[model samples]
Target: MKFLYIFTRSAYGNSIAREALDMALASAAFDQEVSLVFAQEAIYQLVMQQNSANTEKKPHLGVINALPLYDIDDIYYLAEDSSTYNLPPAALVPQAKALSAEQFSSLMSSADRIQSF
Candidate 1:
């Protein structure tokens, strides 16, 4: 089944983001088709210059960058939110594609299972 994971939080200061990533990765390991969407504040997780220097949590980007290696490459972020947050396309991780509102809606419609965090 196709599994969609939606992330709507920052990368640090909490474990939610990492936990979600772990779950998404685990789903892929089990041979599930996984697609990850970073929305709202979660877009920050895709920014190239993530500085978790002051936070106790290890920088989560390392895990995100390794997603393609796990064969989980359907990564996306909302284009509207990205622009509103002033996140230039160049600043996002290479694996992340910008999805238009209609595309996002269609994606949600197509997923067999979706987990939001």
Candidate 2:
């Protein structure tokens, strides 16, 4: 089945982002197609060069990088959110794609299952 994981929260200050990544990895491991959508504050998760050492929280870049290894490369972020946050394409991880709000909605609708974090 095709699974779409929507992340609407930041990776820091909570475990939801990690949980969503885990779910995506697991789904991919099971030979299922997995796509990730980052919207709202979740867009922060894709920002490169994050430093979490001071907070003692594990940096999420490692997990984000591992997505490709697990064959879960369909990563997308809302263009509206990126623009609002002044995030240029170069500021995001290499694999992140910016999609218009309409395209994002179309993707969600095309998924067989949707899970939000």
Candidate 3:
């Protein structure tokens, strides 16, 4: 089965972002096909130079970087949101692809199961 994780929250200030990553990793470990979509403020998770240690929050980039190691490389973010936030694709981690709204919808429609955070 294919699993799609749609993340729309900021990486900090809450546990949902980390919990979503955990679920994706666990699903991949079980040999399920998993894909991640970062939308809205969740795109903040892909930005570089995050210093969450000062806030006592766990940094999310490390877990994001490990996605490829677990064979979970299909990471995407919404281009509209990125532009709205003035975040260029170059400013984000290399593993993420920026997709248009139509493409994002197509990808979401292809998933067998969807989980939104």
Candidate 4:
């Protein structure tokens, strides 16, 4: 089966991003093709410089950064969302592709199932 997981939350403020990451890893473990899409607030998770030192929350960058080791390489971030949040695509984690709205829409259409958070 194929799974497209869409996450739209920030890494530090909520559990949604972590949950989606875990689900993606689990899907990959089952040998299912998994695709990850980061939209809206979720785009913040891929930014290279996140310092959570002042906050009481921990960041999920470690988890996201490790996806490639588990064969979950088809990760994408919404280009428009990134632009809306003022995030430059060049500064994101190297493991993901930044897709335009049109490209992301095409990806969603190709998925067997889409789980959004």
Candidate 5:
């Protein structure tokens, strides 16, 4: 099955990011095809220089970085959002690829199941 996880929330001040990450990992562990999309503010989760110390929340970057090891390599972000958020390619995690708006819509249409947070 094609499992698409869409994240639209920021990493800090919420549990949604963690929840989606956990579900993605679980889906991959079960040998299902898993892909992740970081859209809107969720793209903030991929910013490299995050410090959860002040937020009093555990840094999710560790698990996010470890995704590839779990066979969850099909990660992506909304292409235009990078420019909108002023995040250059260097500012984000390396695993995620850029997907244009049209491509993103096609992706959504192709997925067998989708979960958004």
Candidate 6:
């Protein structure tokens, strides 16, 4: 089955983003076609310079960076959402793709199942 995960969770707050990543990874491990999209504030999670210095939160950057190793390489960020929040593509993690709203919608349509967090 093809699975698409859309995560709009705060980058720092709780474990929502982490849980999304974990679920995406698990889905891929089962040999399922999995994709992930970051929209709204969740786009901030891809910022290359995430400073967790002030908080005791474990920076999930390392985990986010490991998605390819887990075979969950269909990562994307919403352009409209990122622009609304003033986040630029340049600020994203290395090689992370930015998609237009239309492109994102098209990707969503191709998904057999979609779960948002």
Stronger candidate by lDDT (1 vs 6): 1
**TM value for model 2:** 0.96
Task: Please report how far candidate 4 places residue 102 from its true position, in Å.
Answer: 1.7
Candidate 2 lDDT over 34-69, as tens digits, reads 999998999999999799898798888999988899
Worst 10 residues of 1 by lDDT: 50-59
If the candidates were sorted by their lDDT against the true structure, best first, what order would they fall in? 1, 3, 5, 2, 6, 4
Model 2 scores worst on lDDT over the 10 consecutive residues at 11-20
Q: State the lDDT of candidate 5 residue by residue for 17-87, as single tens digits.
A: 88878989999999999999999999999998999998888898998899999999988999899999998
Report every candidate's CA lDDT.
0.93, 0.91, 0.92, 0.86, 0.91, 0.86
Off by over 4 Å in 5: none
Per-residue lDDT of 7-73 in model 1, one digit per residue for the tens? 9998985689899899999999999999999999999999999888788668888999999988999
The TM-score values for the models, in the order shown, are: 0.96, 0.96, 0.97, 0.91, 0.96, 0.93
- The top-ranked prediction according to lDDT is 1
In the range 18-62, model 6's lDDT, one tens digit per residue, is: 887888999999999988898887888888988887888888788
Misplaced by over 4 Å in model 2 are none
* Tens-digit lDDT track of model 3 for 23-78: 99999999999999999999999998799888787778899899999899899999
Clashing pairs in 6: none
Question: Could you tell which candidate, 1 or 4, scores higher by lDDT?
Answer: 1
Candidate 5 Cα deviation (angstroms), residue 40: 0.2
Error of 4 at 33 (Å): 0.5
The backbone clash count of each candidate, in order, is: 0, 0, 0, 0, 0, 0
* Candidates' RMSD to native: 0.8, 0.8, 0.8, 1.3, 0.9, 1.2
Q: Name the better of 1 and 5 by TM-score.
A: 1
